[model samples]
Target: MTASRSDALFENLLESAQRLSFDSRSPQLYELESGDDERHGMTPEWSPLYGTPLWNSLTEQERARLTRNEVAQFLGVGIWLEVGLQVALLRAGHSADPSRPDIKFLFNECADENMHSLMFVGAIEAIGAKFYQRDRALDFFGWIFRHFVWDEVAYGVVLAGEEIFDVMQRDWMTDEDVAAPIRRAAYIHVVEESRHMAFARRKIRDRLVGLSRIRRAVSTLIIAIGTHLIAKGMINRRVYEDLGLDWEVVRANIDGNEHHRMMFRRAAEPFIEFLSKEGLLNFGARWIYRKSNLL
Candidate 1:
């Protein structure tokens, strides 16, 4: 478009960024310590094994242990995702006009995400938890995503990660019973990510105009698979072992866990609705989401 239009878009984005920017340095951001109860890590209903026989078999203490480990694993995954997003966003910004609003907001996003990583790491360390690595088998997708931001597909990929977690964090922040530390972290993420999600949605929708149906179909499948894998990877099988739970039994429960399925579905609602509105959630993509139980 015109130089004036890009400058206008950038100005609006930068204004929002300056208005909502957060500081990770506040002493209040890190005041909670996990004592006997680790409920702060996660709510019981969020556990993968919640509502299963295995979950019923555990004492409250044991449940807290599991929650702690499970939450830590997710934060580890957050670190991984935020790291990738920061890299990809920075790289994608290279083609932007350095003086434009998009580039400035892109850099702002990177800064926000870096602070998020530090906050997540602080939470993990405070819980005395270990980080879980992503399943390397899917590294190729990461490579493709990192290298390919030319299409609107790239922002859609970014939104998938943000929206899924955004929903969950929204829930956490609202629940009065959630621990302050977790609540605070979720609160921070929810606030800042609201802006990021808005930016991503705007970018995707604006860029999707005039795209061919064939390309949209292909990107839809790629995004579906990416979302499925990202959701699956967050469970972190090794976390069960770390918590002294049998992976086999835990896996069995998670496979058919109605609560887990519901959680996935609920968390995905806004994302699915947005994509549906955009006409990206086509028949083939719907089938994939059904297979993943995220529809």
Candidate 2:
């Protein structure tokens, strides 16, 4: 409960997770194989390399809009909340016997996430885009990382996001109307998340459930913070901004007043349902869904 304990927990978790970086077969390999799919569809649609663009497509306007979306999608929403949870969990494992495979899997996942951010930025650059941090929704979930958080809560928050993201990627793979660029993104994610989600379910079931009471309490608080962060990130803003729509007006259209919370809920709904049906719906899990206004 002390700050020192918390800091130590984070450090250990990160160290364990870092083990994956040295693993021979990482999602990074899949990314490397994804060469020039944007220019030619030589790879299968399900391949992680299916639609990777070269660095030459963006005009100034297009790049700017893409950069905004990238900041919102990767940095603001994904990295700060999702990857941050992994770091928190790694730290928590310091005092306990953390699963090496799980930590490694998570580390690999972090690598994938980092690559995804790079890929998004690369796509923007291919089209010639630049981004300004000021345009990001900075205050949206600034409260989540203000204090130490527990592992269970952190895991649940991460699991919920993964579930939502996985579902989105699956949909994109199946959608006939999805653009090539989006499909490429989906392909890479699906390949990685297939393992990540499986790992999450096991980690939560086996590892998280066995933690001490103090850890459980911390987990709950972390999950709550994660839930709120996710809820705030679901609005489709950059598209509207690209079209010169007022931010408020776009929010109104996407999340009309009481219905303003719908986007996050709808996106997270399948995960909520899955957890409930699987009997994995802990307070932390439910808290995440509720924060998204899904349950």
Candidate 3:
């Protein structure tokens, strides 16, 4: 895409953001009606243990607790990813021309992400769950990306994370079976992230032009590794352990769960296709994606 086209795209995004922005302190976020505690924190079909014999053995209350923990893990990881994106956006703005439409859109996106993180925190708290700690190794890599990466690589990583969450949130937001706070937060995130994703895709497409083959390969590998870490880190083993289940057994069930794998692949499909068309799905990257069960 040409520079003018890119500018126009971001200008449009900025307008939408300005018009649809919401307050994080809205009272609707705190009001929970009767029986809200009994609702699932996410769609039941998206549960990692769904359809497993072990899952079948759990009582309704136990199942609800497990889903709550799982949702907390997702929200916690989302907070981590959002913080990283905010850092990357600030870093990009530091060296960018303030007059650029893309930079303005990114700053707006950073503000949106801050509110989204707050919403995730509130949702996790409302679910009566604690944040799950990410794997140390993934945290280290996130630190590197937050501090140094830029251009297409930065936007690619951001896009991958957002796209995965977007898919799940689209389901959660509209599912009446989900908790009210979770559903509301998901709705806000899905709406706002639509603009962010558009901006990221346009940036990635614009930045990838004329890139050297070797650099593209390296960038592809980095994005794949980041995505693999994200997928692996989304569900913490502590979630099962805290719920009084053996981590090993739960891990085994999840590994063999075709339903869970299919959900992941479905979540990744659009982004995977985009990467392929952008020439970012080289052999190494494709292998990583397959290992992550995202391909």
| Top candidate, metric lDDT | 3
List of clashing residue pairs for candidate 3: none
Task: Give model 1 RMSD, 1 decimal.
Answer: 2.3
**Residue-wise lDDT of candidate 2 within 1-295, one digit each (tens)?**
3334434544554554454323223334224223322232111232211122311233434433433343334323554554466566656655554444444445566776676655544543333233324324434343444346544455666777777666556755555443345445556666665555665565565555456767655555555555655655544455346645566744443333343244346657776665565455567756665655667
Each prediction's whole-model lDDT (CA): 0.78, 0.50, 0.89
Q: Which stretches of candidate 2 lie over 4 Å from their true place?
A: 1-76, 93-99, 127-147, 174-176, 208-222, 236-242, 257-266, 277-291
Candidate 1 local lDDT, 1-295, one digit each (tens): 6446655765776787788766776767767645524454676677778889998998877787787788787777776778777777778677777766777778888888899988887766665566766677446667777777454666777788899888888877766555566667888898888878888887777777788889888888888888877777778778898877788888999997999999989888999999999989988899989988798
Clash number for each model: 1, 15, 0
Candidate number that wins on lDDT, 1 or 2: 1
TM-score of 2: 0.59
**Residue 203 lDDT (model 1):** 79
Q: Across residues 1-295, which tens digit of lDDT does each residue of candidate 3 receive?
A: 3999888899999999989987777867856757878888899888989988889999988888899999999888888889998888787778778878988887899889989888888888887888777789889998899888967888898899999999999999999888888999999999999999999899899888899999999999999999999899987898899988999999998989999999999999999999999999999999999999999
Rank all candidate structures by their lDDT, best first, as comma-separated numbers. 3, 1, 2
Q: Given candidate 1, what's the lDDT at residue 152?
A: 67
